[model samples]
Target: MSASDDYKRLQLALEAAGLDLWENDLVAGKVTHPATRTFQELGYTLEEVGDSLAFWMEILHPDDLPGVGAALEAYRDGRADNYRSEFRLRSKDGQWVWYANYGKVMSGTADVGMHRFIGVTFNIDDRKQREEELTRINQLLSAQNQQLDQMNGHLEKLSTTDPLTQLCNRRAINERLHRLVSTGQPPSALLFIDLDNFKKINDLYGHDVGDILLCQVAQRLQSCVDAGDLVARFGGDEFVLVIRETGNSASPFRTRIEYLCARILSILAQPYLVGDLMLSTYGSIGVVCFPDDGWTVDELTKRADIALYRAKHKGRNRYCFFQPNMETELQYQNNIETELRTALKTRQLELLYQIQVDRNLRPVGAEALLRWHHPVRGLLSPLAFLPDAIAGGLIHDIDELVLDTACATLGKWQQDPLLRDLTLAVNITARSFEHPAFADTVMRMLEKYRLPAGKLCLELTEHLKAQSFPDAAHIIDQLRAHGVRFALDDFGTGYSSLEALKHLKFDQIKLDAAFVADITDNTTSQAIATGVIAIASAMQIEILAECVERHEQLEHLMRRGVDRYQGYLFGKPLPQSAMEAAMHSTLGAQMA
Candidate 1:
């Protein structure tokens, strides 16, 4: 086909398709198009639209010209693949309408007359109007919700928002921690910040000044963390930071935490002028990581508290990561005592019995041991808190509970044939043993349960003071009269004296665990075990070995005439329900 015929067919197709085809002679500054469709749609005449590129510029919105010019420049300089502009253009009626223009700049060659910009245009006013309307509706909804919050956010604000610094409170942090952990996106590090010398500031300057200083410190703490990271006021002079994102390895992640804590210390060390006096204070930060230091909120907070104490003790204005050994020191005894009291009050105390067995490893009886189910620390044995309990004057109370619980279990066992004959031993504190009514309490328990003969034994520990010796004989005599057995516990560890004391009638001598542990290896342990077994044999008293864990140790002790054995080789300590279940299983096996 001829060129003119092909061009006419192309123009006809474009016009039918609602596209306005246009071209510009760049060097000559002239405009041409196959049709005036775009101009007619926007209420402009062909004559008014004019033949010059300058006319198009005159009608374009001033705000859009700069963008159009940049697009044109980029295309003309070969920096862009094509020239495309979305802009508003004024119509003959003086109303602005949206239009999209697309074109390609081609240099003049033999096929064309001059350098040309060829393109198409489409009026997009309706689509633009719909987008603007949707945006307006969203903004209106957001504004209305904000207004509602301002008007009716009473209890919600009181629970989550802090009144003093306008930051989050500890309660909010706890809730957020729960949500985050539930969603499997818990924070990586919890930075617990405590201001140094804050109490002195409160004392030297008044509490009013202290309050203002705290508010200023809260602001600085917010500045130290990221936008999504949580910053909360954990109480007076104490702030907490929850870091939302850190790498997931222990070593590199801890490095980042160390760097972040250092940066916070550096930033907060700056002096702040509150009212008239310039206040200078720095922070000590304790850091704990998720899945490293702990996973739960209670555990993390407990670990962070320990870390913070260490930081302050080592000297102020420093940061410390949580370490396992820190909680083992005497520094935490007071805290343990306080929380242990709460544990007892809240019924967090539990008792587990390690099944004691005869020579054939048959379950005979069990030892009732106390375990503390701390809310933050999980299940803990006696060594973890007994020293503090003793110093805090709580051991006596603890013993009373243990004694009562053991007796109750014994009473429950009387209903089942398999469990009825199983003797249960409970440790008795020196304080409880010395009480004048101690014998009376034991007598009542013996009468209440009608416990089987030799089924309830009171194991006397080495904690008895010299003052308790005077009354020990009388207490022992009364309890023995009621068929309650007495065992001298830890026989070789310095309290081997019921024999030497000459007044007490003890039924059993439990070989101390220290000797049983190394009976096969250590000569001294062998000698002690042999001596204990020999004495008990001559006296016709039953000799039981404690902590007889290894098979070798058990075999050796049995050879040496040890009458009974208790330790992990038989079974671990079990709760009451578990103990009953185990007894039932054993009874079923024996019957089969």
Candidate 2:
């Protein structure tokens, strides 16, 4: 087709499609496009919109002109195949609106007369608005993401902290240790601690006082360790500490932990007063070295726990290291746990009884002691397996069995005319006292055995005297209301023992074996025993001395006017039948 005919058809299509078409002859610097209506709509006359290249450039926004010029130059230089531009332009009403312009090279000839170009423009105000809206949305989403990341960091901090003590939690400390090991950090130490019978503080004063004491203890721990060290709460009454080192055991790190343990023990040993209540506390600490004793979290904690067990076993209120021999102890503990589990299943546990005599040497009561009849190891005392059972959560089952057997035996013993008036004493641990079902369990056993509740005496160590006093009081009241009598065992040991006798109704006070065993040689022990006897006498509370082995200790206790005496001097713990025979042989003559 002829150029004129082709131009006419292009103009017709541009008009129909809402596009303004134009052509520029670069060689002559002239513009030509027969369709003049589009430019007229933009307030330019046909003559004004004529083939001058300058006219199009003049209409563009100043900032957009350079880019458009570069595009044209690039196309002409054969560096590009097309040119496209978007910019603001004046409309007929003098208002500026966004417009799009696009064109392609029509010829490659260098001759000015032959060079030609074609282009078009369209209104794009709506597209420009949509682009601006998307930019704003992107900015908002970026800001929200940053805020969410910050919130997540804050929540993580909160989750890993102890609120009251402001220390890391057990989980947090473990995670930190795991991270250190995984990242190949230097060696360190783990300090495992347990407050020795912390319950006594709460049982004597109140939980509020206990909480204050805990806060103070946390502060003391912080002061004892370096800033780099971490003190964490492992749970109630237990704490785990992580200490970093300077490659020298002689340095402050190792010494500091030991020093801290001693200082803590000393500080806690001091008596605490909550209002009218005064009490004392102590703690046991276990030490394990990282990369020495252990390289992982579990290994360290396990070793620390083993050491703590040794501390408690050796008499509490002290610190112990994870010695090489501890592995043997650990194995022994494992064996005990296994055997206790088996004993629970096989009903192989037995109860031995020790006769309780009155001040006149007349049998008035008996104490029930648990004995394990191991098929292979012969008989084992409670000392050999009770700790493991308690640690393994088998104490409840053990206590239940002990209670049942004692009730049944009491029922049988009550049938005898002489033993009918005698009471049977049962030792109850803190674990048994904490059992939520303890009341119902005791009541059911008593009912099932048809034993009178008055005939059952529950002996509790003075340990509870320094712990959660309100809870202890509630338990004592509940049990006493059921016709059961309470005895304060291990008296003169706990700081709150005297207060316990005064506040709680106790039918008897068992002088601690420590005091009784040394009464003959230790003037202080004898003085304490004499004072306890006098106090019990004043309160109308009977006194029972345990471990009265020596003639002098027994004679001294007897001279002090104790209500009862029980020890090897009377007879060792024996099976029920043997105890019955002993009573028949010793006291049978008196009855006759």
Candidate 3:
């Protein structure tokens, strides 16, 4: 065949295979037979290309040059069996498209004038793009799987661990106890520790400090126990320590239990550092032996509880053992419940108002606080007897009375312009507010007194249950429509404080007294207060400072943008007559 015929047939074969052959003259430093169809397929015309090595070099993407050179060098050095490279080339449309080439060097033979490189160039853009996309999808799936694994691990941890102290939770403790019993391990002593005066510490220091104290106590408890021993947070203000091996003999075991309990009491009683303040608290321990006190977790917990109360009853900061005659605590509680019932009916329960003032220190409103006048115990604060009332389910009755008296007081106040604008904030328990007739009763009182619904502010506590929020929202919305402004009481202390804000709209949030207790001296409290104020402001909700008992606290709060104030620095809770008189005095001064 003629050479021209052979060249034509080869070109036809290359075209049929979806490829184009190219020849580079190494000595001439130019491309002789260019990949014409490759350029044409990428939207480049023959006129756009000058068919020079420079043109090809200029079109090669800068990022792909090193890899292509590496492949060419490896083949030349005989390190690679074949020379192959995939690279991006700048197309006619000013876009980069992927192309690949396979080539071999042909030495200058007797007839050849110079060394020549032969190669076939083909478009691999679709395949390359698909491969890249598949890689990305695989990466996304791998990341998702890792996140799912993390989420599941977190869920498992939550089930077995206390979120706050990171100790074994009640469920975990129960499981551990069950496992020990099932395996018939050495008898373990379960010491039920109820921190003494924790409520007082929590109330006086704030929940922030209280939380810190709990964590510190958990750490101390862990430090006191052996590695095999388990220390768990059984409940709020409660802890359980399990001694894995109490030994077989009674004398040494009793001595060991005594020593451990005494050590825990001493260690726990030591002062705790919360923020900048050092506070002290003690624990009352109830010591019980497993398989001896009772077999199951429930029976052991129940008996331990009895012993714990016994320790509290005798005196706080001591340990007690479960005895047959330890049923005295129940009777005492029942007796108190009986007295509370009597106190409610006999008008011994009364309302007191603590003045709420603006930034200017002028009275804007008053929070209606409850006081109990026990016939035998003289006058007492709600803190003294409210627990019994709540425990006996008599808080709803107290709420009813407070609402009634507060409305009557509101009705009387409106008769005088001086006191009409002063709002009365009444605290309502969750159960009381959730009642079917609760909204009607409130509206009824407002209508009967002919008072503005704005004058009677209902304070919802931070401790409202999440499950009842839907219904609570309905009632709050109903009352809100009637012009009854709601305030979130104890805003920063609850677990779901921010969640509550998200779910229910409120006119104001009473920053918990705990946050205010040490705000002036504590930077943590300052940051928390500042952050909360900022959040509340973003929602257009007013911020009210609670327990602002010092001028420094008030100044700090004012600078931080608090809208209102209430505490001992203002006025202590007083009777309706006294509260009105003080308001009258303050209003007269303001007018003058």
Candidate 4:
């Protein structure tokens, strides 16, 4: 075949493969392309064939120009055997298209520096676009995976930590205990701590302040522990500490544990400054040693809990070690709780009325005191089963029974003119009073008994005075609007302040028996009593002296401007029959 026919066939083949062929003559400073028509179709023109490098540089993307120029120069200088570069060039239609260029020196002498190059320029826009898309998708997936990993880590942390105090939670602590027991390398002691009167703090300051106090408590606990020990919040106002001993001796280990417990108690007992209020609280700690108390987490936790209960029962704000006998006492207490639950259903519960008299010894009111006549055990006072009732979540039931019985008695008393004017004072538990429906329930009971609101007085302990129940003032106001009166019972014996008394409206304040017990001789007691009376008088609240058994005590209280009195000096608590008989006799008239 002739040379013209072979060149035509080669041009047709290159066109069919979507390749544009070009040749550059370096010494001549000229460039030539075989497919002029193809170049026009791709939005380019080679009208100025000479100075091709300058023309290509003009068409190239500014960011890609330097890289392409460097690649060409290296190949020309024999530093690179072949030239290959990918670059963006602006097409005639104002769009940037990716192109891959391949070239080699067809004729060159390295020393003389004469060179002619031939290469193929291929349109790689589609492949390059796909590569860019894939890169973007990979980056996005990587970011999403990282975010998911972060979220999972946060969830794991949340599961193991107490959100309020940021301390290890119960589950985390239990798991740590299991791990430690499995290793069995070191002797460890577990201390169970329960804050004393924590509920009272929650009630008086509300949960917001309560949460702040809990965080402070957690910080104090952490400060008391060593680097190897762990402090975990075991829920509510309870915390558990895991202390590992370095030595093998049991005696020194126990001594160290006791020291830690004492230190913790001292630190936690210090007052906490929550917002504007300075509050005081204490902790009861129960200690148990591994191998000595139990081998497993459940057993040790149970024993520690029992010891904690014992600490609380033994005047609180103290620490106790686990003793085998405590389990028996715990079981007995549990049995008492079981029996107390049935006391009301079996009609074993009764109310004894304690008479309250005015300054003239006139009967003005009576306090309904609860009594339990156990089937096996004889009659028991509130102190005997009240704690059990509270722990068993049955105090509300007892409180309701007292309210119902008192209202029923008042309903019958309405028939007698002498007793009609006599007010009935019923003691209310803090839990019952804090119930959302307490006010409504009390009003309903009064209506059911046809008892006028003025005929009833709700006696609340001084503990309730410190609680920050948002609706407390509202509830009190609502009841007072219906003529119901309230009195602060056991007045000088609780954590109450003048600020609380100002906000909590009370019709009267009762002097606790302790304050009145030796008022005549004890100047401090007399002064306290005097101060209370003066405060009550200034607040327009009546003062009632309780446990006034001696004439000197009575005279002292009378001299201090006490409005009413209740104690054994006048009469002890009486049964329903005795109370009715006394009311019908001259004794009731004299008391009235």
Candidate 5:
């Protein structure tokens, strides 16, 4: 076929395939239109095209107008030859639609020099619209994911924070402090703050008012800090401030922090506005600089802690900077800690039994209290080594030792004709409840000693109930299934709400010594103890009052109807040999 016939056939084919081809004479600056139905499909009509190229240019979307004009100009000035560009065109309905309109020089002769431009306009508006929609949808999804991630992060923060005070909790603060020091950051400071006699307010008025007072204290603490400084809730009635960027001149920062501490104390000195109840409170603070105080977070906290001890020692409502002598004391504490670890390894620990008496002053069972009869120090109470052991991560070792000893001691006693009926009670730490091997460990101890599971009673302190319930409940279920009973020790001390008490399946509630000590003189204590007794009776859980020192205290506690009384009044804690002798005498007396 001839070239013109071939072109004609191709145009016919293009028309059949739903495409339109057209030409413009750049030299003449005139435009020509080729008939096609695709323009109608895109909301455009043939009657809309004007006779000049200027007419089509007028319909370009404003944003696309400049570039299209530039391209055409480039072609006309011979700066560009072939042209392919995308521009939005106003459809017949007057709405702008993007189009891919490309062209090539077709009719231009070399002699006439490239004046004719031919091109096809394809309706790609649907594809472009779908692509734009997809882009927009992707952006929206990305933003939603980012927001979700941020919300999750906020939830995590909330989990580790005290909601009312908006401060990091003891757990969070300790973790962050450990991380900061472990990272080997050179400069930092730890300031410990404790609200003085906060309980007196709670006792005089109510916890609601006390809560309001604490919130005010938190606000004051926040106000005292600069941006980016961290203030955390070290625990009940205590808070901590970590100064990360104190600019190397820690003294000035320390002074400012001390001033803040003084300000906090002063704020509490004023009457607290609690629902028309005017109340006054006080606070104590201790400050310690990093490296100067100690290298590790624990060391720094320990230094600040000793300073806090001194503040409380000198009297409440004061502030104390850690001094050289304080470091000396810390060194002594360190030496004690080292000695404690060695003592644990050498099995120098011992258990003392404190007799438990019923309302009739009859001895029933004895509590297994841990005592460290140090090689050189003679005898030391659990308080002496327990805290240091917990701090040094040796609590598990100590607890295991206590558990094994108690089991062995009780197991031997169970074989005795006289002491066989005695129940052995052991306290469970928070770590012990969360320990994955707790049930297994108890079972193994029981098996090793050939003791009945029912004879072994595990005492979990009130603080364990304050932890998350799912795991605590699971531990309870597992241990209870092994015929082991549970006791809530120090029952009135922590999170003592009915909600907390009801969640744990405690077989008994050990009244804290504080309540027992006050039972004789304090009416409030009497009422509280009565209420506790009533609750235990209703729950069918036994009640045991601790620290029954005086005969009057024992009489009052018995009258209040406590199931058992434990204290010096019965007998001070005795060594194993003493306990065995006392047991034999009691058996002989009972037989008589």
Candidate 6:
């Protein structure tokens, strides 16, 4: 076919495909295209059918011109096989339209004098607009997802943390402990910390000040632990620390754990500044090492609690390790507490009277001591079960029982001429003495039994002297106003002070048995006992020497001017029937 016929057929084929066919003559500096109508429709016109290259250049978008020029140059130099680009071009109305264009050097190579370029252009504005809108929506969704992820992470952190201290809560700590036990990686020690005297602070100050103190405590605990370790607030003033060690080996870790515990104690004991007030507190720690203590969270927690009880019991502000014997003792105490509650109702509780004598060995009064006759354990002394009663919060019931028994015995003795002259002394726990109705209860018992208040002496331990209670002095004064005698029992053993002695009225001071136990052999004991006696004498308080098991001890106390004595040497604690028999026999001998 002739070239003219082929060219016309080619133009017809390009028109049918919705493509615009064009040619650029390099030597002539002119361009020709068959689709003049398409350009006119886009708000552009070719003033001449085959115009110079400047006409197309004037209509191209400024941002896409450089790229299109680069692509065309590469194709003309034969660097690329074909020239193709997607760019925006200005239309007749000044709106930008997207177009895909393709061209190639059809007439000659780069070495030739001139080159002819043939190409096709297609309008792509609709497809490009759709793609841009889809891209914008994707970016918006991605940003929203990132924000939601951040919020979810924050909420999860809040759930596992304690808001006040910003430490792990009980649930989080339990999970951590469980993970530690299950993995068995690095060895760890769980230290249970209980703030000593924190409750007293809350009672003295307000909860606001108490909360500040707790926050300060939490900061102190965090400062003492390593970064790998965790300090969690287990509610209130209690905290649990997970101390992560280097390896599974425990021998070398023992010393480190001890040092850490001592360091924690020292740190927590420091005074804290809460607002304008400076408050002091200490911590009692209970430590249980992993695997050695237990293989589960619950087991370790229980063992740590047992050790904590021991720490508090031994006197607070110290740490104790879990001992096997402690578990056994705890179980036994639990059993005693369960059984002691029903002892009184079942008529198993009895009061035994231990005789108190004057310097000449004549009966002056008797101390009412509690004894439990258990169905399974036979006769049990207070030393065996009293602690359990106190721990179980049932000491008040036992105290009331003892008072009732003592008052009934005194009422009965009132009818006996010889025994009526003897007084009765009942020991009162610090807990019971602080009761709001303690004084009223005592007065009613006195009135019911028809016994003079002077004949009933209430004994309180020296420990009660250190505790500050607003009503303590008032209670003592009220009972004393009615001629009720009071004695400082177990004096010189606890935190007793001269100020306490001066403020609280006491008719007598009973020396603690520990001092009398070795008063003759130990010079220190003798000096202490003598010093106590001198102090009591200066106060004009009657002195009573207790646990005097030998005649020499009695003689020594007598020479020291002691007025009363009670010990095994004089007589052991006897039941009411035995005491009655002994009292009658003594009366019969005196009459003889």
Which regions in candidate 6 have their CA more than 4 angstroms from the true location? Answer: 1-155, 246-251, 359-362, 415-418, 434-444, 447-451, 465-474, 492-503, 512-533, 547-560, 567-571, 584-592
* Model 3 agreement with the true structure over 1-592: per-residue lDDT tens digits: 9999999999886665556798888668777787988888778776667656788888899999999888877777677655677789998789999887877677653134446888788766765579875465346546755222332343465678987898999988899888977887876888899997788788777898899999999999999988788999987989998886745546777678889889999999999988789888899999888778888878778888888877876768999878756666566777888998888789989999899999888899899998888888899987787766776778778888989998898888888888888888989887688777899998888888888768888999977878668878899999998888899998888799988888887998999988899998899888999999999899999889888888888888899999999999988888888988888898899899
**lDDT value for candidate 1?**
0.80
Against the correct fold, how does model 3 do in TM-score?
Answer: 0.48
- Across residues 1-592, which tens digit of lDDT does each residue of candidate 5 receive? 8999999998876654435687777677777654245456556556665456665667778888778767666666666654545678776778877665556677755235456778776554654579875465346546755222332343465568886687888778778778777787746678888887688688778888888888888887888778867888877789998877557554666576666777777876787777888777788888888767777767777788889877876767998988978767667767888898888878778888988777766666788988887888888887777766765677787888889999999889887888887787887677666667877888898789988667778888755645356678877888788778888888777665466576778788899998888787799888888999999999999999998889888777777778988888778888888988987897679788
Model 6 lDDT tens row, 552-591? 8888888888899999998899999998889878766877
- lDDT string, candidate 4, 356-456, tens digits: 88998887878898899998889999989988888778888888889989999999999987788888899998878887778888888888899876888
Candidate 5 matches the true fold with a TM-score of 0.49
The alpha-carbon lDDT assigned to residue 212 of candidate 4 equals 98
Ranking by lDDT: 3, 6, 4, 1, 2, 5
Weakest ten-residue segment in model 5 by summed lDDT = 146-155
Instruction: Please provide TM-scores, in order, for all candidate models, with all chains considered together.
Output: 0.44, 0.56, 0.48, 0.60, 0.49, 0.67
Tell me the whole-model lDDT of each prediction, alpha carbons only. Answer: 0.80, 0.78, 0.83, 0.82, 0.75, 0.83
Best by TM-score: 6
lDDT (Cα, 0-100) at 472 in candidate 6: 73
Instruction: Please estimate how well model 2 matches the true structure, expressed as its whole-model Cα lDDT.
Output: 0.78
Q: Better model by TM-score, 1 or 4?
A: 4
What is candidate 5's CA lDDT for residue 4? 100
State the displacement of the C-alpha of residue 241, model 2, in Å, after optimal TM-score superposition: 7.4
lDDT of 2 by residue, 1-592 (tens): 9999997997776654556776677777777652365466577787776667677667777887787677667656766655665677666677666666667646654223335667776555554579774465346536755223332333465568876687898779889889867876777878888887688667766788888777777877787777788999888878888888756556566676677778867876777665676666788889998788877778888899999888887889999989989889678878888888889889899888988887777887789998899998898888877888887788999998998999988898878776677788999887787677888898888788888768999998766635456667787898888888989998988788877766678988999998987788899997898899889898898889987777787788888998788888777888989988777777678977
**lDDT value, candidate 5, whole model:** 0.75
Sort by TM-score, best first: 6, 4, 2, 5, 3, 1
Model 5: residue 101 alpha-carbon error in angstroms = 44
Worst 10 residues of 1 by lDDT: 146-155
